[model samples]
Target: MEPPRRKASFLASMKAVFWSFFGVRKRRDYEDDAVNLNPVQVIVAALLGVAILIGVLLFLVKMAVSQ
Candidate 1:
């Protein structure tokens, strides 16, 4: 008999999302994440990351234009 598998932690999912945003994930890591990560967690993390990126870009642009 096999033991039950554990779900991925929020931190782990966030790390996976971060690596994915940079487009530099290894195939082995991808496979591991696929098995461990929750789809909902991935989606939420991705959306938050994108929003943060956009906010940072807007802040930089505003600062550059104001100067």
Candidate 2:
């Protein structure tokens, strides 16, 4: 039988997704994340992170243009 899955906090899920965005995760960390995180959390965090990144870039461009 499979072991019970540990539910990681939202913050931890976000951190894992953030590191994944940069493609800089250690093997051990990845394995740990696999045990702690679920696909849905990762997908949601990724979408949120992408939205934030796009918003930041747009803000920067607007500021540069306004100067």
lDDT of 2 by residue, 1-67 (tens): 9876779877888999889889999999999998888778888888999999999999999999999
Per candidate, the number of residue pairs that clash is: 0, 0
Q: Work out the TM-score per prediction.
A: 0.86, 0.86
lDDT of 1: 0.89
Residue lDDT tens for model 1, 1-67: 8754649988888899899888999999999998888888888888988999999999999999999
Q: What is candidate 2's local distance difference test score?
A: 0.90
